[model samples]
Target: MREYNVAILGATGAVGTRLIEQLEKSSIPVKAVKLLASKRSAGKVLQFNGQDVVVEEATPESFDDVDIVLASAGGAASKKFLPEAVKRGAVAVDNTSAFRMDPEVPLVVPEVNEKAIYDHKGIIANPNCSTIQMVVALKPIEDVAGLKQVIVSTYQAGSGAGQTAIAELDHQAQQHLNGEKMTADIFPVKSAKKHYPLAYNLLPQIDVFEEDGSTHEEWKMVHETKKIMEGDMNSDAVKVNATCVRVPVVIGHGESVFFEVEDSSKLTPAKVKELMQNGAGITLQDDPDNQIYPQPINAEGSTQTFVGRIREDQENPGSYNMWVVSDNLLKGAAANTVQIAEKLVEHDLVRVPAEYYGK
Candidate 1:
């Protein structure tokens, strides 16, 4: 049993905190744990394996002698610190979108593309939280019956935006209940000029809108699905489209996914359910007669992707629909990021080039 030294880059934040919890219970033997955050969060003590670990300011030097780096900082911070960690000989599994689409970095969901982890050049990118759940449900189907197209509409949770967004949702709900004015500031992109209240209402946008009218969140789903499934965005084999929305939920993300199977005659709703039931990291909850199905409330803290509402489109026999749910913070961000690190260790891919060591 070999133990490895690990560092968590954003140890005080929502996803960062979850990463700590996941690592605590993980099968990987952790010799030492380092908690790194920004200067403001430094000196905060977090619990790991029944010991107090103080958060330190993240710098290139923080990666010294670390074997694995689990990074959940924001995109800017990840873009800055992850490379430094890699350069310092630590294999960084990143939860931010900073390096996902980079050809040199591997964007991996362990259940979907574990082999991709071996191809990493010192850094592995974790796909967007929404993309991770959708792909988990779709991967088995894609294998049993070739996938031709995918269309997904997501009802995302406030936690996807971080702790501030979740807290704002709670505050706004209280304001609505007390007949006070609801404030808008975080949902639908915090940096955008216009913000909206997500309490008892839905916003049809997740990230900032692109030039093509699609929000950045939707674009990530579109492109990331392709990258994870076929490993190339331009692959003519499969097409993906998404509409991401922010709902008032606090933890889990719910999605309605419609997909077309290339070989329609063989793949049916029952077969799809059977495939998913046996799929890794997936739980089949489709029992229409008993009113059993996946829901956000039921999936709050679970790591497995809950899938239900399996049915084929009546008009198009080739097209089918299903519902998917998972905790956005756990499986979507922290759990998946940690899973990539686990895969790296399992496959003995945790080491980088010699030049990166002590450089």
Candidate 2:
């Protein structure tokens, strides 16, 4: 196996931590693992291959000699370090909203758009967490029925908000149980003065609401889905609408998806199940009599997208309903980002002129 040096930017974040864990079990031979984060997190110890790897402050020069960089930090972090990593000969797979829409960057789901990896100019963008699972569940069906439109509602987890948000939820829950005045400091919108309880409550907004009233998270799913499926956002073949909500779950993001196909008579629930079960990056968990289905707890730490509860829409003849679930930190971000790096290697798109990554 070929060995490659790897870097994990935003190493202390939720997705970043999971990315390291996945790398531990990955088939790719990792020569070295560099953990990069902010200056405050530098010197922090994170375990890899049973050894403690100290986190270092990230800088444009940090990518020297790195073969692959899995960046799950945020849009701002990606905007800052991606070019730097690329300049240093490291191919970056960013798990942020930064480059998904860039005409030059391929927004990929390995199962659906792995070939797009060949087009990477040193950087690739992973699709949104909700968008990733939905596409995994819908891709096989689209191959048969021909998708025209899709509407999705996502139940996102607290972990998606970062670690501090998770702690805030736990703190508020304990206060709620103790009959004390509970406070919310990390939800609804952290920057927005008012926060709310996530436990025993569903917050209808994920990111800050835009001028059009849709949250940025919802818009990311809508636009990113089209970009991933069709390769261009302007394609007329796909139309999507999404409502992103935050729930108290610590892991998976659950999506209730409704979709319309160009032809319905050619497909059925059983056929969908068969295709999905055999599909890449997806696990079909649709047994009804045994009361089997995809749940958040069942999806934790797993990279496969879980899909179940598939049924035909009663109101619309060519429409269907299904539930899609996944470990947002894994398949939604980390695993997908790693897969892009692997694809870059497999397609020979990564190893550019060494000077291409140098300052």
User: Which number leads on lDDT?
Assistant: 1
- What value does the lDDT take at residue 188 in candidate 2? 78
Report every candidate's CA lDDT.
Answer: 0.89, 0.85
What is the Cα-based TM-score of model 1? 0.97
User: Residue-wise lDDT of candidate 1 within 73-149, one digit each (tens)?
Assistant: 88899888877888878899999988888878888988888887766789889999999999999989888888899
Worst 10 residues of 1 by lDDT: 230-239
TM accuracy, model 2: 0.95
Task: Kindly report which residue stretches of model 2 are placed more than 4 angstroms away from their true locations once superposed.
Answer: 232-235, 353-359
Per-residue lDDT value at 6 in model 2: 94
List TM-score per model, in order.
0.97, 0.95
| Per-residue alpha-carbon lDDT of candidate 2 for residues 256-312, written as tens digits (9 for 90 to 100) | 999898788877777777888898888889989999999999999899999899998
